[model samples]
Target: EKHLVLLRDGRTLIGFLRSIDQFANLVLHQTVERIHVGKKYGDIPRGIFVVRGENVVLLGEIDLEKESDTPLQQVSIEEILEEQRVEQQAKQESEKLKVQALKERGLSVPRADTLDEY
Candidate 1:
């Protein structure tokens, strides 16, 4: 069956389910990484994927008929990558402003990189 798998790191993969284990590990054939930005999306072929159980965030069967009727438009890979880059830059700018505001109030924001120092 065709399935859509979302990983912990925010990757969406679509492929045919080939195998699975008790721990939720999966083997997907003819896989592709799907990237979406707003109403546009692009798929990059990944061939086969072996996903670890621990990284699995969500999994669901894909209805082929309804999949074709999605409101989203498919864009070229180059365009999608450019959009993704812009989106990430905007997010980073907002995050930096947030951290700046916190600092202005004498509130230090904990950095994710420093969390392991303890």
Candidate 2:
């Protein structure tokens, strides 16, 4: 069956289910990494994947009939990637401004990527 899988790292993959184990690990065939920016998306062929269960956030069967009816436009890989890069940069800039604002008010917020010492 065709399946759409969402990974913990915010990646979205779609492919045919080849195998699955009791541990929830999955094997996907003809996989594609789907990148979405705004209302547009692009699919990059990923071939096959053996995904660990822990990295999977969600998985659902795809309805073939409805799949083609998506309201989002499908764009070329290069276009989607460039858009993604711009979006990421904008987000990072906003985050920096937010942190700076908090600092100016004498408030300190831990960085998201930093781990607290035990």
Candidate 3:
């Protein structure tokens, strides 16, 4: 991903680099203080030179990983059938529970009623 680093001194550096030499290495641009770079999860410790690319101002950043096309996995006929059976079983169990709850509440559950009526 391309990222832009805006330094404390108000200068910005735009680049398409992964990381700096080291986690402690600071990058210096024109009129900008040494900008930190690299794997920082939270507030970067002072004197540690590792600024996350996302923390800086970026005009544009494209995810190269998302650009690659990959074929989706195919489901077998048996697997589809199994999934449908499980879904049907769950629906039946849910209806049973709903009926039981209505009985407990002293409410009459209508036979052959749609789910919306419940």
Q: Tell me, by lDDT, which candidate is best.
A: 1
Candidate 2 clashes between residue pairs 3 or more apart in a chain or in different chains: none
- After superposition on all CA atoms, how large is the RMSD of candidate 1? 1.4
TM-scores for every candidate against the unseen true structure: 0.95, 0.96, 0.33
Model 3 lDDT tens row, 1-118? 4444564444445444444553323342221122222211111113213555344443334366753342433344455446556667999999999999999999977777556654
Candidate 2: segments with Cα more than 4 A from true spot: none
lDDT of 1 by residue, 1-118 (tens): 9999999999999999999999999999999999999999999999999999999999999998898998999999999999999999999999999999999999998988778865
Cα deviation at 35, candidate 2, in Å, is: 0.4
| lDDT sort, best first | 1, 2, 3
| TM-score of candidate 3 to 2 decimals | 0.33
lDDT of 2 by residue, 4-35 (tens): 99999999999999998887799999999999
- Tally clashing residue pairs in candidate 2: 0
Ranking by TM-score: 2, 1, 3
Those runs of model 3 whose alpha carbons end farther than 4 Å from true positions after fitting are: 1-73, 113-118
- Clash count for candidate 3 is 3
